[model samples]
Target: MRAVVVRSFGGPEAVEVVDAEVPEPAARQVRIRVAAAALNPVDAGVRAGVFGGAGKQIGLGWDVAGVVDATGVATAWSPGDEVVALDYGMVKPLGSHAEYVVVDADAVAKAPATADAVHAATLPLNALTAAQALDLLELAPGRSLLVTGAAGGVGGYAVQLAAHRGVEVTGLARQDDAELVRALGARHVTEAAPGSVDAVLDAAVLGEPALAWVRDGGTYVGVIPQAAPAPVRGIRTTAVEVSPDGARLAELAALADEGVLTLRVAETYALDDAAKAHARLAEGGVRGRLVLVP
Candidate 1:
């Protein structure tokens, strides 16, 4: 099997597409014949020496959509079941960028018939993160919510989910990408130069710009780990690290099937072009998720 691996952490060029042994399922785990994998910002962070020795020479990717080829224990999944999953955690390795990847069965959900592998591949990481951030905020319907970097994958989903829950969403993004955010149902789209809002969902990954967004008593959620926003006095600051929940993925799949949510695919690359994908993501301004057809 072929997968991208980093020999040294520095740049996208450090990633190498190498032939490797295909893994088998472990206890309560399953092997997926991956149809596609999506890139997350964390993948770029891990590749650029962001964590120094801890993340060097690692396989970095979390979003995957595929079919079950083998399973260790039967809960609700079996061989050949179409699925999507978040396969990594604080200590777990990322392996979804490969031809076949093993994941804990408890972390995956069946992909809806309404969505193909590409949609499934794009949903796990970003959508899950948005869900958790919203959860942490303890927000409710009719509340005023504001999101920065609202044109990207997670931001797009964040807008829709908040809107679905009946919250009024205001999005901050590029003038060009504002329509994309609005299409996801953001009530207001502003090119406000990344400053000031009611409740802040900071997808820009920058701290200060996001800090300026909220009132003294608002909720602010930052998606990047280690890039914690300052403790704005009188405000609730939440740092969201996405986790794999089989049940939550099922819920997201249901939304997609109902035509209530949409997955935006900005582009697709072959497995070997992982480097270019990384570069594109790092450059910013992409409107949707980028996937690798493996």
Candidate 2:
């Protein structure tokens, strides 16, 4: 198998695409012939040494979407069932930047038929983050919810899901993305200005500016765990680190199948150009999730 080998932590240039051995399934694991994977900020950030890589020396993608080619245990799946799954939490996690990946069968689910391989690949990490963030908010109808970085993958999904629940949704993004954010169900959209709200679900890495939008005693959730929140301002803030829940992921897929959600692809690159893929993410302003076709 050909894989992008990361020998050290630094930048995109560290991702070296080279010949590697194909991975096989272990007990309770399924080997996926990877068709696609998504480029997430976490992937690029980890490669850039912005976030701790957890001693990773292999590859750097967290999302995976592919077909099951083999399984260690006899289960409901056959040799060719399209699926989307996250490999980040595996004990000896295999990176998704390869032609084959062996992930625990319990960590994956069938990909929504409504989504093609590239789009299905976008769901695992980002969408799951959105689901977890919203779940933490315990969103209430008629309550105002502000989604920072609303045009990005996690934020975009949060806007729509929160709005679908009839919460008064607001989004923070650039002026260009205001309409796109609005389309995601934000009742109001802005490029980020000083304001207060009932609760702020900040997917945006809005540093000190975060203090402006969250009201006293309001709840706050952050995607970036970098800066500390000013809880002294009477705001309850916590970092929403998403975890892989197969059942919740299955629900997200079902929502996609029912047309309650949509996938956004900023671009798709071939598997071999994994370094270039991470480089593109570094240049910034990724309007949507980036997908890699393996």
- TM-scores, all candidates, are 0.93, 0.92
User: Considering only N, C-alpha and C atoms within 3 Å, which residue pairs clash in candidate 2?
Assistant: 217-234
Root-mean-square deviation per candidate: 2.2, 2.3
TM-score top scorer: 1
Candidate 2 local Cα displacement, residue 82, angstroms = 1.0
* Model 2 lDDT per residue over 1-294, tens place: 877656677778887777777887877788898999888887766666665555665566788999999988755566798888888742233488789888788778889988898988888888888888887777689988888889999998888888878889889888999889888888898734455577788888775567677677777888765454767477777777777667788888998888777788899999888888888988889987778887
Winner by lDDT:
1
Cα displacement (angstroms), candidate 2, residue 138, comes to: 1.6
Q: Residue 57 error for model 2, in Å?
A: 2.1
Residues 1-294 of candidate 1: C-alpha lDDT, one tens digit per residue: 998777677778887888888887878898999999998777887777665556434676788999999888665678889999987743234478989889888899988778789877988888888888888777778887888788888888888888999888888788887778898889889733333455788877767667776777877888876566667757777688888898998899899888767887889999999999998988877777889998
Q: Give the local distance difference test score of model 2.
A: 0.80
> lDDT score of model 1?
0.81
lDDT of 1 at 187: 82
Residue 251, candidate 2: alpha-carbon lDDT: 87
Runs in model 1 lying further than 4 Å from the true structure: 54-56, 90-94, 191-198
